[model samples]
Target: MGSGKRSDYLPEDERGASFAQIPTSFGHELRACLRCRLVKTYDQFRESGCENCPFLDMEKEHDNVVNCTTPNFNGIISVMDPARSWAARWLRIGKFIPGCYTLAVSEELPEEYQNICADNNVLYVPPKRT
Candidate 1:
């Protein structure tokens, strides 16, 4: 229970069922970073988000999945192709899991993907999920 003053001080907009509407579901491929190693889905893990896990920020939620059109890189340029980029680049795009953001490339790519990122200045590296 909370203190009376704290309860009363709670903003009206932040109260009641609106709080309940917030979604909190982990993905199937959810893993925890135990020590330096990445542990696969927890068999009997606690429900709430964990501060200790490195993968906490990387967890993918069901609401985030949408078809992304990714380009094919066959080591060529000057040809136009539209590869998939997540609509919500804020979510780190693909590479995580069901909603992962495993890939972290520089603003510009190296040899193979140079042309594509040249105009856009973004690169996509495939993520490795266990």
Candidate 2:
């Protein structure tokens, strides 16, 4: 958190949470979580995994990161307050940690990963494509 401006938006307890850094500039390196749509750089995903979908255990797992994230996403929405932000609620990320998220992810989580979600009792809702 390091007293950064972004940490100011987070509650005191969550200021130290390990969410992805906001992309300085969008590019091919960016990827979105298939489950929560949290946006992060490919390297970031390898290093930190998805803050919202820790069950994926993507950190340091190349294949897991590849299978659980996608570069094909549209729009980025930064949510500072999940509980109160109308946009976060509309996007169905009200329970996710504060961070940059995709408006829509173009790909689906693999079937095996979907089963993992089920085993964990996490509902896996495919992103609406329109």
Candidate 3:
């Protein structure tokens, strides 16, 4: 078996020890990041923030967490090896940290946060509503 430390499998930039745990079950409190679609409970988001979208600074900021994350997402995907997973590539999350991600987030991020993303050189693509 592999070592217990999940950080060992993550990339250098994403080596935060806290991101090792990914939510595995659907729950009412689960929310998905508007930018990266990483799935986590409300408390988890408040505690650790989004692993892929740290610029949002969701930790302890209830407003940020509420405005940047959506509970209306669809489908859950657990990505272990983003570099080699065709599903991750197809979902455009190949460069994101390995974790449970939503297939589609069904809400829009606030314009303010969108601008923040732009200012940070991060593209904010809204989810398709088809």
Candidate 4:
């Protein structure tokens, strides 16, 4: 039920799927930030990506935005030793265990994923399912 224009429009190629379209079947340990595209996992609840997110500061509506529980990630970066992990330093994640760190796969999802989201009434994705 759109007005033939996207409010989230950002050029043609840059347009991508929203974070809600991402899968949650992976498990509770994983979470993805739609804004920063950071798909890192946690050993427990406290380690999620909610802390000090760049998007949280940018978006004023704290309630409507997604939480730390976000899942079904992409672009994994494995850190064998978090102490010596250069990626962690770059991403500004002060603490990370030895595991795969996935990047958020927001926007421009593959056609197959788009179909999946559409059929399931994906709230975050922009494409209309007709």
Per-residue lDDT tens digits of candidate 4, residues 4-116? 44222222222221221223345665665443344444332232223323223223444323442346545666555555677765753324333444544444444543453
The best candidate by TM-score is 3
Candidate 3 residue pairs in clash (backbone atoms < 3 Å): none
Candidate maximizing lDDT:
2
Candidates 1 and 4 compared by lDDT, better number: 4
Q: Rank the candidates by TM-score, best first.
A: 3, 2, 4, 1
lDDT score of model 4?
0.39
Residue 9 in candidate 2, Cα distance off native in Å = 20
TM-score of model number 2: 0.82
Model 3 regions lying over 4 Å from their true place: 1-20
lDDT of each: 0.24, 0.79, 0.78, 0.39
- Tell me model 3's lDDT, rounded to 2 decimals: 0.78
Off by over 4 Å in 2: 1-20
Error of 2 at 23 (Å): 2.9
Error of 4 at 44 (Å): 8.9
Residue-by-residue lDDT tens digits, candidate 3, 23-114? 74467989888888889898888888887777788986778999999898889999998879999999988877788988997788899998
Tell me the tens digit of each residue's lDDT in model 2 across 1-130.
Answer: 4443321122335424745567656888999999889999988888877777777889867799999999988899998888799998888887677889999987889999988877666778887667
**RMSD values, in order shown:** 19.2, 7.5, 7.3, 13.1
